[model samples]
Target: MIRSAYSLQAAEAEIPALSATPLDVVALLAQAHHPEAGAVVLFSGEVRNHNQGQDVDYLEYEAHEAMAEKMIAEIINDAHAKWPLKIAVAQHRTGKVAIGETAVIVITSSAHRHEAYEANQYIIHRIKHEATIWKCEYFTDGSKKWGGNCSCCPPAL
Candidate 1:
């Protein structure tokens, strides 16, 4: 098996866990700042007003909290294995989220722009596709769909 390019253990993150409260993007970004890191990247996954042909009113998320957090931490570790990072963090919200609200955020910092960008992308993608989190969309049309598992962004207007 191929090992990490940098063998340093990933620092235990206080982020990368499920949140019942709003995700604090600014605070997480601040925490990701590091003197050694020349580039910091952040991806915010927000709740949108629509999806597919439905006019969405709001969203509700649920998760097996412990399992989701453990998976996210492992994703962060995988990102560390691929890139030499100064900081890496991710968090997702559970319960109700209104339109224009942020549901998830991932932050990464590295010595170069490329590493930070790629690692941040990797973390968010893995979290969306692999985490135990689930989303339910409530449409203004009075219908609801129970699975859009990813915290997807609003499509262009």
Candidate 2:
């Protein structure tokens, strides 16, 4: 929770239930210009029960916290460099998570909607594909599967 000229926001937490990533709060922070910034964009990525047609009982997510945070910081930096972003925030859940829980949220604010949207998308995409995080899947059959690179379970691409 380090505050900066443009807050550096990111977290790796255990998600057990519903999480609120309200646009207004994040937007207000990003749109420090508030009344002057008229547009905001927010994206929430939830943890769904099914993946590749398998019935997911729950998911266990693990990450190299230090590295993951560093990666998120870079993504935010890139978003700012690539867009007219006023504020940026991204969060991801770690540890056990149930179905329908939110795993990630990205919020970006700009003077315009277009820039906000682009920055939001960029942050989410990087978090999903580039973060140093891994997921384990528990299925209805009492079996489990791990992310592609996980050594303790089957490969999941």
Measured by lDDT, the strongest candidate is: 1
Task: State the displacement of the C-alpha of residue 83, model 2, in Å, after optimal TM-score superposition.
Answer: 0.4
Give the TM-score of each candidate: 0.86, 0.72
Error of 1 at 113 (Å): 0.7
lDDT of each: 0.82, 0.66
Query: What RMSD, rounded to one decimal, does every model reach?
Result: 6.1, 7.5
Q: After superposition, how far is residue 6 of candidate 1 from its true place, in Å?
A: 16
True lDDT of residue 37, candidate 2:
49
Cα lDDT of model 2 by residue, 1-157, tens digit: 2344323222212211122232233433343333434776767766677777788898778888888887887888888899877677777778887787767777776788988887787787777778887778888889899884322332222
Stretches of candidate 1 off by over 4 Å are 1-12, 149-157
Where's the lowest-lDDT run of ten residues in candidate 1?
1-10
**Candidate 1 lDDT by residue in tens digits, 106-128:** 88889999999989888887787
